[model samples]
Target: MGQAFLPGIRYDKMGEALFCHGEHVEEPSQIRPALERAFKSAEEGKPAVVNVMVDPTLTNLGAISMAYAVLFGHVPYRDLTKYGKAMRRSFLGFAFPGFEKYGIPDAPWPDGWEPIPPEMWER
Candidate 1:
């Protein structure tokens, strides 16, 4: 089999109206500045395209595996009701505990229901 190579394009030569077509900003804190710059350029008749780095939990395996564990005998389940409640919380709790900070409210569980602990993430 022959090797394959991808050709790269020079977006800079596209002129001011298409400025920053392939720009990258590494840090989350840098996103605001990058967006501001892009907006300013666009306001001045030059629109920019930026690719910002983000951690989207792309590799976190939780949902299906957890549900499976609960369904089978790998994990203990004394009370189906309580187990279901924790499983419900596990969907977001295990993967997105910090979601509340992003303005998306945490998943609401029944009152007095114990939340799935962080230890769940370990498995």
Candidate 2:
């Protein structure tokens, strides 16, 4: 899968002809900077693509995992609820706590709800 991105990166070198700026984010720390550049380029009337490299071995814990964990008591129900709420808030334009430091705008959480810390995300 990682190899598949090489062609796209080469194509982006065409620059103005493509009307798009491309960034290859190879590490976690690169995410914000790449996204910032992409946004800046788009704001200047050019489209942008940030090709973020992800660890293929890292399994995502999504809805299925949440349900299984809650049902099997692998994770506390309240914890998952908090994480779910945080995700919902992010979709609604509120940045999760740590993400705010990366230039994402932060909004107050609804009363009684706080974003679960990033350290708890995979657990």
Candidate 3:
């Protein structure tokens, strides 16, 4: 199968909507200006869409906290290992079907990462 490419942004308005074009705005450097303009319009209660071209090399850290919450839903400290095993199986096992023995590498934290305190997870 051929590699998929990003589609070109369409500029056509079906009816009464105004369409603003950001020509050749397909780089990480071009995102901030587009966001600024979109936010300004949103603040003023105007309909706006910021069509940004995402660079794959950039780690999309935008939803890190939310994604973490979803993946490990309020897991208690005592059940960390259990939840961790489930997550590992769900993500890695399915990727390598029938390779149950494929080991997932240890996390790359040199000094070890701090665990979220148990008190925080009690709620």
Off by over 4 Å in 1: 1-22, 59-123
Best by TM-score: 2
Error of 3 at 89 (Å): 7.9
Model 1: lDDT to the true structure: 0.45
Model 1 residue 115 CA deviation in Å:
18
User: How many residue pairs clash in each candidate at the backbone level?
Assistant: 0, 0, 0
**Model 2 per-residue lDDT tens digits across residues 1-123:** 001112335434555367689887779999999889989999998898776765433334442232433344443324444344333434433323544555534433332233334443442
Number of the candidate with higher TM-score, 2 or 3: 2
The order of the candidates by TM-score, greatest first, is 2, 3, 1
Tell me the tens digit of each residue's lDDT in model 1 across 34-117.
Answer: 788878877887668776544322212333344543454333333223333344444535565554565533444332234334
What's the CA RMSD of model 2 in angstroms? 15.4
Candidate 3 per-residue lDDT, tens place, 1-123, comes to 011123564332311156432233467887788677666866776656655555332222322233443456455423444323333344434455543454444322111133322232221
Clashes by residue pair, model 3? none
- The local distance difference test score of each candidate is 0.45, 0.48, 0.40
Looking at model 3, residue 89 earns an lDDT score of 40
* lDDT of residue 115 for candidate 3: 38
